[model samples]
Target: MAEGDPSYIDYEAFLDPDFSPSSFANTLVTSTNNATDTPLDLSTPLSRVLFDLQEIDTHIHALTTKSALPLLSHTQNQTAAADHILKESGTQVAAVTQGYERLQKEVVQKWEAADEARVAAENSLATVRLARAVSRCLTLGKQLESQVAEITGRSATGAATSVGVDGASPSAGRDGFRALERAAYTILSLREMFSAAAEDEEGYGLDRVKVIRTLRGEFVIPTENMIKSRAQQTINRFSLSSNSANSSNGQSSTSSGYKQARDARARLATAATTLYLLSPEPKSSTTAVDYKPELLLSTLQGYMHTAIMTSVNSLARALSQLPSMDRTLADISTRCQDIVALEASLKTLRPPPHPLLASTPTAETQAAASTNSNLLQPLLHALDTSSLPSYYWRSLASSLTSRVQEIVNRGGVSARTLRSNRDRLRIEIKECVLRASRVSATSLLAEKGRSGTDTVIVGNWEREAAVMVSSVVGPLGR
Candidate 1:
């Protein structure tokens, strides 16, 4: 059969060299034409079926040719356009794939670099913070050491420390104490620095020993030295006043002596508080067990003892010669003079070290206060007689009593209140003397002859007494 035509082939005739395909095709056409002319016989079923199939096949082939004609023309027209699109698409895909690969490699590298940079920056910050903490702590420690050395040198040489522009030491007087107070306050603030610096070490490793030891060596030890130096100076001043009083003629240094003594006592209190904080437990985690700085507490007690004794001794000697009622009154009047001096000294008293720098008191501190209180008993007993209500007129005594009462009423003493007290004392003394004169005159009159001419005698006696009193009161002119 031919490829384009599904017609029966005569292979035997084809094999014969005499039979050509064109001659055979003409014979087939002649037969079809002859059959068309004589085909009135549709009587047999098989012949009828074959003839219908032949007609159906011819109709189908014609319909297929008609439908495929337009499709062929359209394909011929679009062939060049389709080939161009395919070729361009393949090139574009190759280029896009290469570009995507490059982009992926670059993105991966950049992401890795950014991550590394972030880690490095974080590490640098941590290192900087650690270095800062170390530097700050060490620097503060060095300053503390310098202060300790300054204090020790001054104490050893008996030279006053140069504080700021004042050219004075805290040991000099009230102003010196003020400087010491400021120094102590600054030292106490170091703990806060430690806390703030410690917070940065979240995952970072830090040496706990270095931190605690630095605080101990730099801050705590030097503070202890300051306390001891202050206490020693207090004792020395008390000794100087005592010696001066002993060598002077009858006059007393009780006022200045007591003032210095009281100041020393206050300083000791601050020292005790500081010591307690520095050495809280027997084995402190923040400090060394063997280096608690409690050794000087005994020295502090000695200073306090000497100071109180010096004041008491000076007062006792001054009062020993209270020969008359007036002298006793005068001594009593002057008793609060020392107290007034003490109040003035207290006005300029330095505030205690801040609690952050202060620690719990040790057994030695408690003992110091206790032993001092015990030793003060004799001084208290000696002054008991002076405080009692006496039959003799307390002209100066009343004034001094009122001065003490005013101080007590005001809760604490100040410069202003002390001045007011001095003023009131002067006024009260005058009033007391006037009242005493009246009492004396009335007694004289009662003792004399009251029946006849007693008024005249009493008047004459009072006139003479007033003259003598005026002469005695002359030296104390307003």
Candidate 2:
């Protein structure tokens, strides 16, 4: 609006500071600048207060009384914005209060309903248990009465009653279950109680229901005595087998022959298990669970012999094209199987001589001994002769053949005899190894001698030749 408008005042001349037309503006200027020496404009704080008071007093006089400004609905945006903020804040508070009330009421109601259901379920479980208990009591009474009648009905003079439930003889059959009538009854009662305790009022209306419907799914809680009895019976059977093995054969080196070998092994394993159980303390050995030394020895010897006998024949049959060397490799080659199989089957911590091997010696072994004597005769002549170097092969072959002949001709001997025969060959091989230009061939001869006519010899010869081939080629650069 222009300064000349009705609301605009002529205050530009007052800014000249030459004259004051208004008393309020004059008093305000004087009080404000007295000590400060600064300009006190009409708009100063003291002047503003005075002007407002003058305006108020003048209005009061003009209208007799001034009424407060009516609280108007805001036509201006600032007033409307403030009203909008207050209204939104109140609505938010109401929403929050309503949410809190709803959640609290839901939680309290849910807890009460859960408690009621729990109480009902627990009450039903208790009722079921009580009914079962009563049924159990009645069942027990009935069982006792039956037992009493059975006892009373027995004739004291001649008729004899069997133990409790079944007439199974304590002698013919084991388990002595007939004597455990009372305990059996108690078990039945407890089984019933457990069955009832597992159910709720819905399925079992006062009558005890079978909680375990499937017989296959039923629980089996064996008593300590029952477990002990079963274990003892098993143990006794094991002990019998173990004892029998000791007395059977083993008198002859081949006493536990190949025919009865399987039964022997089974009995041996069983006996070992029994002994382990009977032992006051158990060891950590894998076989300690069932290691019977005697049985183990018997089975081991039998298997060893079989292996030696079988391997020799197997190797001979397999390498049919090599028949020229068959007679040489087969005899002892196969028997080496005995030695090897004997060793393989042994699970002991030591490399002891197989008991059977020690006791029983084959015919081949006896021949080896006789051949050794003949071997000494040839060595004397061969060593002294000037043609020894060239004739070494011939001499070695002849000596080996003589040994083989002895082994074939002489029947079986003792274990000591067999070892003695091996010792002779070992010494001859060691001695001839130095004198004989063809040591590899010489060693082969020695093996053949010991192996004799047996297929085992041929097999051993083939293996030894393989090793000899390796040794010879190593130095010759072949």
Candidate 3:
């Protein structure tokens, strides 16, 4: 309202929900006149109040009339929106219910068939695995049979063509060794397969099959035994006597004796390799009674034992007959050379990996078998030395010490002769070491084509020579 007007009203104050008529009247009266003024005229104020009320009512009517159509239109639009939303929600809910029903129906209809298909797939896979296992078993069996036939054929041919007094032919020996190696490889393959099948969950009943059992009993075990026997025989025939004679005569490589010795070594190497392949795995049992040495190691240890015993006996006999000392030393040196040569041959020989082993289920086993193929490592480990020559010499020294002590304890002519030749004994011991080292080096150089200027030294040969001399001379001096 206008400030100059006599009938002005604050219509905005009346719109407040908390507005009170008495409070408004008091404020208006206070704003119009102070308390010191004459009492307010009631008639003028009442008239102005009525006029203000009429003006406020008119403005309210006009505002309501102007907003009527727009309010109706807004209400209708809201109602239509609510109906459309309800219809769309019903349609979506119906579609979802139908989709759920269809999905449940499909699941109920196909559950049994799906289960059957899964089971069939599993059965098919198991059958395939079983077929593969059987195929491998039969293949190994045939290979084993073939190897046996070849070995037998070679043996028969060797027997028929026996021109020598010993009934041995070089070609026959070579062929026999090759056949044995092949047989051993086949047997190993079979054993590995059996082991793998035993560990495999899918390879159920493989070992119990009649054909597998038959092969294992009739062919595998017997062939394995035969190979061991033949290999042991070959190792036993390894003699230093022939080698010593050939060396003493200064025979050329073309000589019959030299060629025979070479052939013998070749056969020995092949046989050793075969034995290694056939050797059983090391047992896990820690008990001494339960533990058994591998076949190859035991055989090699026996060979070393035999050599030691023979040398001790020969040297003891020579101590009595001093004239034989030179010959005995020569023989011992030849034996050392043979040992060196054998060590070289074994180190150089690497057996081919079995083709089937790679395809076997056990990779750790394949790796282990490959590592065990090194023939020299096992012997060296058993002998407890890195150098074979050093082991042999040191072992001989230790063995001869007691023997020489016993002989000198008798105080007879042998003892007197040994005491008189103490200096000569020392010299002879040194010469024996030098001769063995020289000849072994020469043979290795010739075989391997090593540089001529390369010096060959047996590990601590000087100490070994001292040990040998003391073993004999100490007793004499005492």
Sequence-dependent TM-score of model 3: 0.61
By TM-score, the best candidate is 3
TM-score of each: 0.32, 0.24, 0.61
TM-score attained by model 2: 0.24
Model 1 over residues 133-211: C-alpha lDDT tens digits? 6676567666655555454434434564554445555444453343344344445545445444345543133345477
lDDT of 2 by residue, 1-478 (tens): 2223443234455467777557745665677666566654545756566775676566556544333233233345668898999999999999999998898789877888999999999998777666655565445544533432332333324243444355533321332222233333443444434343344422233233343222212322333234224323332232122222332344341232332333322333333232223222223322221223342233333433343344334433322323333343433332332232222122222212211112224566555434433212222232353222222223333334333334334535432243344433343333322222222111121222223221111111332333332322222221
Q: 94-144 in candidate 3: lDDT tens per residue?
A: 999999889878985588788899999988887787778778878877777
Clashing pairs in 3: none
Clashing residue pairs, backbone N/CA/C < 3 A, model 1: 170-176, 276-359, 276-360, 277-359, 277-360
Ranking by lDDT: 3, 1, 2
Which ten-residue region of model 1 has the weakest summed lDDT?
A: 452-461
- TM-score for candidate 1, residues paired by index: 0.32
